[model samples]
Target: MNPEVNEDKSSLYNKVVEGKAQVYFHKTKNEVFYNPIQEFNRDLSISVMNTYSNVNNNKKLKILEALAASGIRSMRYALEIENIEEILANDFDQKAVDLIEENKKLNKVESLVKSNCDDATLLMNSMSRNWKSKFDCIDLDPYGTPAAFLDSAIRAIRSGGLLLITATDAGVLCGNGADTCFTKYGSVSLRTPACHELALRILLQSINSHAARYSKYIVPVLSLSIDFYFRIFVLVYDGQMKAKESINDIGFFHVCPECHTFYQQNYGKTVPTRGNVKFVFDSTSPYDLNKCQNCEGTLKLVGPVWTGKLHDKIFIQHLLKYLNTKTTDDFKTRERMIGMCNLAYEELDNPLYYILDDICSVMHCETPNHNVMRSAIMNCNYQVSYSHCAKNSIKTNAPSEVLWDILKRWVELKPVKEKWMGPEYRLARILKTQPKIQVDFSIRSDCTPESKKNNLLRYQEPPPFWGPGSKPKRKAEDEENSKQQNEKNQKVIEELK
Candidate 1:
């Protein structure tokens, strides 16, 4: 489990203070691991752990930071969370572990925080061999996909323990590379506006499938798709039957690439009888994706993603409620967390969301305000909610046909440009069809969400040109020379222009 490498940094700070932990690193040379923007990520994790401890009988917890980096998160856990027996902050790089050691001492949490320089997966694998030594909670915040560690993570967690995972490979998970997504997460990701939500589901299914191999199953507590990555929290429990039943949540997404209509079909079926519900193999109907039922566009298959509930309603409510306690008053991301939690709590259990703009773009019509769209959906007596992932998102139970019907009615009032009305186009196929129901666009008071009404930070804008910062180049001396050379080259090019 030990690694041998040049102690080169995935870099660290001169002195960066976050929460109650103050970290000190030897050099600021080549930046790699530390991200100040993730302060919100840290605060959210602490709040969730606090809520978890409170909800789970205040049991003292043993935690593992699988990729500890500079140990900021571990140190924060040791300080902020109420009941913490110990934390093992492990990183393969010797320098990172050394930095962790120094920061743990600096934070004055040496007793509760331990630093380990070993391969994270191998260390967890070894711990998984000993049933009693498994961690109560394990956090995986790797540079890219957490899929590499998911198997060991699933096996290394104690029964009913929390598993926090982060995946930042948004490009692959959002469908730019479906094959790569399959290689990492064993699912096909689709390119759609709801890609973030799709990414969350894909990761959840990946973890659940890995757990299924060892007769365990996951119960997702909260799942979030943040600015550049996906963070998911799920509880692991040991049960052969429950693991078998996980198939009910495993499914594929059928999408119309042109129009962005989607349908979710699970591998298992729910059979509800007089007084009981039964889970059975899906034998009655097998979907054949030939064309979009709404616009006759080509149907593309994208899945097998987790089709189950992304968050436990009660748990999300508990998290939102935890923010109000006096202990969390110092949280810097408190308002943002509150807004996200409110959205997650209000989010429908539907599989995917439609962007109102994306839908209207097909018709070349003006996009209705989200409130207007919300009111229209409610007027049709269908349930709807906002997905926390995207603004202008419409997560609803209404079928695509119904949605097209409403759009058809809208076009009747305010027609689209004649140039877009070609009979061969998807727009024409949709609008030429007759409306099935009486469409209503009357605005409703309840259409405005509570989060919006209170002006909570529902959609915080990322800093301009935001990204995970780049890795530091060669040495400080070489970097200086390269910078000068690039500047001189740029000056010559500018003069030529």
Candidate 2:
């Protein structure tokens, strides 16, 4: 068969991306193809893989991309990363399989990367049954929730192997679809300013619960919330002691509907164990409140989510080091990734974050500068750092009461011009009697100009027709624009050569 004839028959086009691999994908519709916006996601994945490989010192690494769409990820891994023994790229759709085969050949990695057509779950289960713990890395980047494939994928990975999972069902995980989250992830989610962080925790909790059933446990090396989804890289191990320790990380939350004061309760800690393996509850601790402490309003219970450290500090440092040593042009999101790594490295291991806007809104005062708030919190001898989940959020170890007191003091310094009436009057009356505390109003230099430069790299304006929804069917103009961009990139590559 003539290659040009075959390509013409399917109306497929070849595009080289990230300076690494050339892939064949449909132009008019992305329903059965690739999404260019996910380049950051892929870049980070490669960096993590490189770091993990170096840390393990594995000379022959095996990888599995369970839901490989057009085999771009697998091809990139084969071309860009080192020490790869094999890559099994699987997709259930025959058309996708055909494209994967063609792309695999196009990239000249047919000997290293293999394409298979089968249901992802069944394929993973078969691998487990045939060769248990065979893969050094297993990637599950399904279209939506990866919950369905977690069980099988966990069983198929070698002990100490990395498991990469992505969940795009932010609506459910972020609490917009509470019932759906409970049904799928076996946890309750709350839609709050920190919902993105909560979403990451919820996904971790679900993975832990599933791994526990097979005497396995996961230690999250890196957990991040990026555009449109959340991704986690965890190292899975097998041991009774490890599984028991994993149980200790399982916990719940108590959020006040009125003031948004949130509390966390771990299973074995706050929820004490009784003689018959039952829980002993006490009013003074975990079950301490039926009403909001600040406003005397009802408190809603929110979790059973993971309350462990989201990112391993040392691992993040290593990832940054690896990126720094590489001179490859494929990592287009390098600066943005450095910014994210810097934040993750410094962020406190606290469970939840506080939104500055939310805090000021509650206090009925103008929003204070983030640096001022940070300085004030630090003056009180509490740790604070910027949260990667949101731009105006900070994760601090300061108690809610202390935070409220700081806000109350700020309000006193600069009184609200709006007349005090109704809830505002009630709040002012309540805050006036609180103990007065002095705060340093000096500006903080936590984030430097260099850090801002790194962050600015990730802030590209979206396309004119961008909106929130599933990946849309590309129109003719979209395809033409993409083709032009590809040509321009190729010309740049030629010039460099």
lDDT of 1 by residue, 319-405 (tens): 887897734346878888888888998899988999999999987998888888889999999988999999889999998788888
Name the regions of candidate 1 deviating beyond 4 angstroms. Answer: 1-13, 272-278, 283-288, 326-329, 471-497
Runs in model 2 lying further than 4 Å from the true structure: 1-10, 14-16, 28-30, 130-133, 270-287, 421-433, 444-497
- Model 1 clash pairs are 30-472
Model 2 poorest ten-residue lDDT run:
275-284
Worst 10 residues of 1 by lDDT: 1-10
Candidate 1 global lDDT: 0.86
> How does candidate 2 score on lDDT?
0.79
At residue 447, candidate 1 shows an lDDT of: 86
